[model samples]
Target: MQLNKQNLTAFAGKLPCPDYDRGHLQTGIVHIGVGGFHRSHQAYYVHQLLKDGTPEWGITGVGLREGDRAMAEVLQAQDGLYTLVNQRPNGTNSSEIIGSIRDYLLAPDNPDAVIQRMAHPKTKIVSLTITEGGYNLNAATEEFDLTNPDVQYEIAHPQEPRTVFGYLAAALRKRKAGGHPAFTVLSCDNIQHNGNVARRMLLAFARHQDPELAGWIEKEVTFPNSMVDRITPVTTPEVSEYLFREFELEDGWPVVCEPFIQWVVEDNFVNGRPPLETVGVQFVPDVSPYEKMKIRLLNAGHSVLGIPGALHGHPTIDACMRDKVFAGFMRAFMDQEVTPILDPVAGIDLEAYKDQLEARFANPNIRDGVGRICSESSAKLPKFLQPTLRENLRRGGEIHRATFILAAWCYYSDQRHNEKNEPLEILDERAAQLHRAAAGTTTDPISFLRQESIFGDLSEQPRFVEAYTEAVRLVYDRGDVRSLMADW
Candidate 1:
């Protein structure tokens, strides 16, 4: 049987949304980067909102990339319907037919359709999950790369666009021209101060196009900070088949994640907003503290463990968690390198927080890929890993562990040496630079850190450079992460 909109009805028996009222659901939100994470995390949350009440927050997913046509086709056939399975080690808890996604627009295939939706006055929130690298930024300069041909073309032809920032800026220009107030630009990426980054990119695009329009957005728009956490893994063939058999039907984009989910958002919206607070979303004065702990601890933890585990022949996060040495290394690294710098947010217990992370990683049913977490390391490290490194060094703390992290990062980016001694695939913007750097020993850690764009001004720190250099030599010479880590 072909999986389509109606096939979702088969799942109703397994997980019910009896109270869900689709008629009341309004298209109030527009989401960019409607990938697996958004479907599993943000889309699931909004689905809960509709299932309980407040159907006014349904999402219209926008695929920013040209090649995202397959996703568009799948969602369109299903009427934006999909399943969300919360997997635990013991069992599974599934949601039947998440109907929060009302529509989808593949921007390359249907640019006009996307623009029309963006221009709608009813759409009050423009949220994003364009990933760390999708922002089309020069990580070193912390600015939009207008030099990017995609961005340049969008700038040249404002009537049509390609990049996320371009599409957003063009839509805002339409809204401004029509005398419609700008909707809030809510960023849900893993980066720190993501809202500010989004605003900066958008403003940069706008200023280049029209100075007055940039000022207008600065006055009318609100970019609210948010902290979103959920362990959503990429769907595998085995997992997908399991879900299909378990549900008694097919689901093309089922989101399998850990049972735990959280969203801490600032209450800032233009036109209107969702009653997300009703659905357990914490509406706080500031999401900064929560953001800090999540980015520094959980996100950084993933990056820290990613390459080490991958090279150690562990394919899944759970497998890595079960490794006694790796597990302790993570805990100790967090305790020594990351945690002290975290100012407790809203009485959050630092010790208990660490305990929860252990449990989250140990969820056996959730098969998070090291490669997935490991993607875009160059972009992710600046936000997720660099802060902790800087804080520890500033206080004259041990950086040997953090330096090993950088070395592992260098090795991973080099993307070589599978267990079979074959080449591991590299997927990043700076593959060539990394490949060149990886050929010889990165004995001088400063050489890697000196990439001012990624490390910012931190490369100039004498102590940090020393620690990084020492760690690099240790890893290169020893050629064993576990042994080097154990000694540390």
Candidate 2:
């Protein structure tokens, strides 16, 4: 049977389906960027709330880019219903049909409709999962980039907004003029202080358009920082095919993920918020310590294995974790390098959390792609790994493994193929610059480290330079990542 409202009751005995009335659901949230992460994480949470009888918190997902058109079509065709499959480490699967997404709007097709939806009084929250780079932050200055052509276009033509910031400014301005309360802007991205970052970027864009409107948003709006965690991989055709073969269900866009899911949100919504805390969501007074611990450990751990794993021909994170050498290296990096820099996260056992991370990475069924983890390294490394590296360097702590990871990244950037002759896909935004700098590592050993925007004077540090240069030589000259990791 096809996955939709009509076929909901048909799958009742086969798997978990929404037990509530779908027609009574109302849209209280307008989420921008309806990607796999949003579907599996935030949408899933709202689905749980609906299942528990809170029908006022349905989601209206918005897609700003043309790439989101496919998702729009799939969700609309399925009546905004899709299966959420949780693949367990023990090779078992638990699937549920999430029904919190009541509608989807492709913003590129109808930007006015999206702005109007956000401007509506019922949209108490406008959330985002627009990745790390979507905030339009400058890597060097750590501020909103007004020089971007898209941003400039939005600034010039505010009525027909293009970027997320443009859409937000337009919507919030309408809300203010119409005598409606401004909604909370919740950011569910992986960045530390994600809400603060969102607020700063949106206010910057709004101020550029109109100073008075920016002042209203500054005083009236609240952006709640949230830390969301889930191992949702990019959807492959195999996922839908698996659903068809096993459960006799046809879902054009089903989400598949590991059984682990977490969302730590700050309890600071301005408009009336949903009872999300009752549905396994942790409402915290402060989210800093939690975000710091998660980013430095889990996010950094992915990079710890990603570059070397890709170079060594490991196809997935689980593949790298299966190898004793790779596993030991990652463990050592976490315990010796990252753990010391972390503050005491309230109510969380650090050692147990590390163990859980290892288990999560080793889940064979998840098949988390190494290339996916390695993609956008230029953006990811600055937030996830570089902070740990800087802290270790300042405190005279263990920097060998972290430095070697950077060397592996440079080696990976310079190479065309892994050890197994599989093509190494360079997916970073600064791929060209990375390749150019890495190519000069043979003659000038510190070329890659000289990227001031990324490394920030780390090339001048003799200790870091010595370790990174030796690591580059070991990996590039010998072409033996396994031996280098094993010896380290």
| Leading candidate by lDDT | 2
lDDT per residue for candidate 2 within 337-369, as digits (tens), equals 998889998899999999999999999989999
Query: What are the TM-scores, per candidate, against the unseen true structure?
Result: 0.95, 0.97
Question: Cα miss at 437, model 2 (Å)?
Answer: 2.9
Cα deviation of 99 in candidate 1 (Å)? 0.6
Reference-based lDDT, residue 102, model 1: 85
Model 1's number of clashes is 2
Clashes of each: 2, 0
What lDDT tens digits, residue by residue, belong to model 1 across residues 148-218?
89878877787778888778887888899898988899999997888888888888988887788899999
How much lDDT does candidate 2 score?
0.91
Best by TM-score: 2
Q: Alpha carbon lDDT of residue 146, candidate 1?
A: 82
